[model samples]
Target: MTDTAPASSPAESPRVIALVDDDRNILTTVSIALRSEGFVTRVYSDGETALKALLDNPPDLAVCDIKMPRMDGLQLLQKLRETSALPVIFLTSKDEEPDEALGLAMGADDYIAKPFSQRLLIARIRAILRRSALVRGAPEVENDEQPAEAIRRGRLEMDPLRHQVLWNGQPVSLTVTEFLILEALAARPGVIKSRNQLMDAAYSDDVFVDDRTIDSHIKRLRRKFRSVDPHFGAIETLYGAGYSYSDG
Candidate 1:
């Protein structure tokens, strides 16, 4: 059976924020809070409905709870990553919540424990949207130094203009964020891009994305690249530093 996120229309608004949770109270509070901030909000009660709506027509951003019946937020996020760069944040219980380091490994952009404030939630949501928007719109930088290229690696070829990625003479499906990360690392070629550097580069000149966001994207990139070729392991983790793309 196919799974999907529910869709709702708050207004004919340009910006939309989606909230998915089994708890009616949390959904109501978040929806109201987001609306007060001048954003159109869509609320879904379960992962299946949320996934459906998202597939039919995706929202600008989504806030989902970590635990749920049926599909769960983790599965939804993985599914979403297959095609969209929609920004996402997770709501988690204080004691059960995974640490920033652990959560990033599972591909969450941001995680807020149960006792989170409305203000912090709102601010984090806004930050992700702003950064995601900026990063998603950076095809025409017109760099004078590198003669401007689409997605050219030593052996990999990607044409962001066409939204295409290939590794070792084959097509590879990567989320928009994943493709961008790989492109940035390759652009450096032997240069280490620290977590901060990766964040800045991925968000396109300092728009501001969470450090965990970069980590999540990098994890996905490694999976996709390694699937193509084990030695295609161009990305090197400098432990505390960041990442480097070396043909080495």
Candidate 2:
């Protein structure tokens, strides 16, 4: 005898992911990953089978390889976009800037080149899915109802939702490392965070990385801020204590 739920109840539907790639290894790897993430994947070696499935029922997202026989990824993307507004990402062997730009122009939300780290790939996937979820009948994100907006200082405004930092009424581009460092320091105001603490917070699980790399990245970031203004002292270093962000 087996215990069963009521037959009138319905089972949850997994997120459908349509993946198009010719490589068997890639298809298998992607299917396994998506499945682990509660995503139901349909993979096709060629563009034909994938296109038919997409026409029958669109997937939540698509991760496609650019170089494929019969119909290339770009062509398939074009065909899909003809009628659907589904989100798509392109994985390409070509690392050329123009190739990436072309994929972006062709409606790819993001483009990853060959030999990418699987962990980074997962992060990208989550980011795309989060964005898609927000766009599709859902709010971006919500915390407890008792919180206010982020702390602001000087001309810099931090938007954690969009991962953006506006400086002097203009958006400034910062790498992931830079953004995290800025956020951690900016939130503390006058409180100085030691380099070790920053390394722990920003690069917690990061291995084989040296503290000098942090210094190097900060140097580059400071150089970029130098372009903003000479008198601008957004990030202040406290001799040996660490760094803090302030307008004064």
Best prediction by lDDT: 1
What's the C-alpha lDDT at position 112 in model 2? 73
Instruction: After the best TM-score superposition of candidate 1, give how far the Cα of residue 98 lies from its true spot, in angstroms.
Output: 3.2
Candidate No. with top TM-score? 1
In order, the Cα lDDT scores of the candidates are 0.70, 0.64
Candidate 2 to truth, TM: 0.51
**Candidate 1 stretches greater than 4 Å from native:** 1-13, 82-84, 99-103, 138-149, 158-164, 169-180, 202-216
Query: For each candidate, what TM-score against the reference?
Result: 0.75, 0.51
Q: Write the per-residue lDDT of candidate 1 for residues 168-238, one digit (tens) a residue.
A: 78877764456557777887788888988766555544244566668777887787777778766778888
CA displacement after TM-score superposition, residue 241 of candidate 1 (Å): 3.6
Clashing pairs in 1: 4-51, 4-52, 5-49, 5-50, 5-51, 5-52, 5-53, 6-49, 6-50
Candidate 1's error at 53, in angstroms? 1.7
Show where candidate 2 strays beyond 4 Å: 1-12, 95-97, 139-248
